[model samples]
Target: MPARILFIDDDPAGREVALFNLRKAGHEVTSAADGREGLAAFAAAPFDLVITDLKMPGIPGMEVLRKVRAHSPEVPVLVITAFGNVETAVAAMREGAYDFIGKPFHREQLLLSVGKALERRRLAAEVRDLRVRASGVGREIVCASDAMRRLLTIADRVAATDATVLITGESGTGKEVIARRIHVRSPRAEGPFVAVNCAAIPGELLESELFGHARGAFTGAVRDRAGRFRQASGGTLFLDEVAEIPAALQGKLLRALQEKTVDAVGADAPVPVDARIVAATNRDLPERIRAGAFREDLYYRLNVVDLHVPPLRERPADVAPLARRFISELAPGREIAVPPEVTAELERRPWPGNVRELRNACERMVVLCRGDAVSLEELPPLPRAAGERGGEEAQDWPPLPAEGFSLVDLEKRVIERALRLTGGNITQAAAYLRIPRHILVYRLEKYGIRRDG
Candidate 1:
């Protein structure tokens, strides 16, 4: 089939010859005098393939290749190098160039390379589409709040482009869920959706886990294996808790994002990757950057489009619908009604754990309810709010009972409540209680409170 091609060369004569031959071969071709003009032409419209000379005046071919791969990895890039630069051609391939041809190439050679590259891309797209159809992964975003609706609208709009996205919110605010929604709505919906929790993996082994490792790279490395980058090729890669990525490996991650290539541990050559990055984090990345923990350049690369998920407390309207959805999920075949009082109590309580906590509460009610309707008694105890007295309003502070509470006991309870509200994030919990993070850690240890609780 004839393809739409972008031909870029600094030499006017060389470009004319290639353009003439491509048009004669029944292809729609656009000509650019240099790399910058070629990129601008590509941005204006989509093309099937890109052909550029290795050396150019404005932007070098190698730099252009990296930019192309970073922005649209699906597009195949063919480099036109000098006659004796086979080594440079191989290096370009490592940097995600599809193929390289020497200068003074024949018309047939150009046509053959173009044909094969397009065919490979078509086959890959077909396989991806088939896999997505077979999986049938679907989830409805049950939301009634205006904040949530606006967020969804933004997500849908960004999903059409290939820009990297950064999702930020407190823990348990359903960041991963939002990431998945974007992926499902995107043009790459048919591609694989691979997720990795950066915090879940230890810092020492995170590099290998993300970029893969060859055989005998480490103690447990018995055989060569592809990592999340390769596994998510032609798709999306969700890096949950991305703020937790160690500082030492930040540079490598930045390089991979810039070059669209990953060097596996113990591998001689870097592998090309086409996965779109959608990173999520509960921690404040700007703070981390100020503290010298994260790379600012990488932050800019990943934050091409930022999506912030509002907490459950901020979007009270979504509570009832989310509860109803969870109830249906927990009791698939059975019909169960949540009483008005139970839902009222759910909304009244400050949900520190956000959507995740609400889902857990619904599960508990379903398992414990003996009748068709769920009541207030079936609901779990709500987390205690700081500075509250028993059965009294906010104005009635420190309303001690006839049997007064112990000072230590009260402190422990307050600490636990703060921890619960922040989803066990010590730094956030301390800020909520107007204390230092170290103090919160000490109290947690003193009271035997588990961080994961």
Candidate 2:
């Protein structure tokens, strides 16, 4: 429940009834005999939520809502109205009233309205917080592709609060890297970051690693020790491979997340700790949840913010820039040249490992191709997804893909090829396809094409 609710109504009976019901619902309630009193009360103290009747004397309900919205956009304003006041309620929404309850509303209706209103206010605050964090100092995850940019935009909003983040990508897709990005971009950046791999820790020791243990808690315990949560106090806790969390430990984990406190093994007291949670997993959590291996509630809590990193095969356009960037730093005398054909072949092959795989390719090229130039012969195995034009866009290719080839996997390969041919130039690719830059970008992102060198 919110800390306080202010009720405004001209009728003494209505005002008294609203105040009584709200107070009974466990809210600290204050009644206003009129809109003027409501506005005055609003000016004097902080209120989590405000409920006002539409037809009020002195200032009027609409005016009161306007002033409240202007002064405190984060606070929720709920308007109450008669049966035929639907139009007025619609206007109130435009004027920034969070929600409405009719005069003859049932007990649940009133309570639900207030609850939803408070929730809206909470979301607003969280969005604001995320905005601030998103603007924090760090090299932005730079990418010209619309999909990646869109994901980052969503990430900014997700980083604002303690909402659990679930980053999904194939192996080497940089999931953990993005998780750290969120952590550092969050308000809890100053807090310690403790990363736990559900897959790395032995199942038997998983619980101990997460929640800690009391002295003599187990045979191996020589002394009591603080756990990851305590270690990550006032910071963010990242759980990689979250889908691997065991069923037995899942319930305890859910409880700890809900309560923001942990009870170590063999300990009677629950120790409170403040830590923002950011969880990452490569597995399909929804599938795991359906298989009964993962708790549904815990999955929902952790999936509040989800980011899926497209495979290296999908974002081929990122390959070349990343590769050149990777190779340039390693190359002596400052400049390393990228051969167009090598990049073409790089774009042709499906990179199962995403960015991590591309980085390895660049490193290999740097080591093997000692000269400033790298050729297709020195590149890794290539895919035939690109080089299939003929105005068909996709079809007219040979039947039966070679070993490790998939028809369903052409998007990233083709986009990567187009980007490489276009010389890391987005406008050139759009021109080649005779499509708008935005549309081309959309296609590149949709296919997950990262340029390769």
lDDT of 2 by residue, 1-453 (tens): 546888888888767776777778899988888888899999998798888888876788999999998877678899989988899999999998888888867778888889888887788778765664664523335355666767777887777667888898766667777777787767676567788877656677889899999999989799998989889898888898788787999999998988999999999999998988888876778898888988999988777777998776766677667777778766767567898887777777676556656766776777788666887666655434455556564575434555766754664555666666544445445555665455655565566665441
Candidate 2, position 153, lDDT: 78
The C-alpha lDDT values of all candidates are: 0.86, 0.76
Q: Where's the lowest-lDDT run of ten residues in candidate 2?
A: 135-144
1-453 per-residue lDDT for model 1 (tens digits):
888899999999888889988899899999999989988998899888899898999798998899888877888999999899899999999999999988998989988888888897888778766766576643568999999999999998898788999999987788888888888878778788999888666678889989999999889999998999999997899998788788899899999999999999999999999999999988789998999988899899999999999999999999999999999999988899988888888888777778877887898899998889899888877555555545565566445788877888778877776666665656577778886444666677778987544
Q: Which candidate has the top score in lDDT?
A: 1
Clashing pairs in 1: none
Prediction 1 TM-score vs. true: 0.62
Candidate 1: how many backbone clashes?
0
| TM-scores, all models, native as reference | 0.62, 0.55
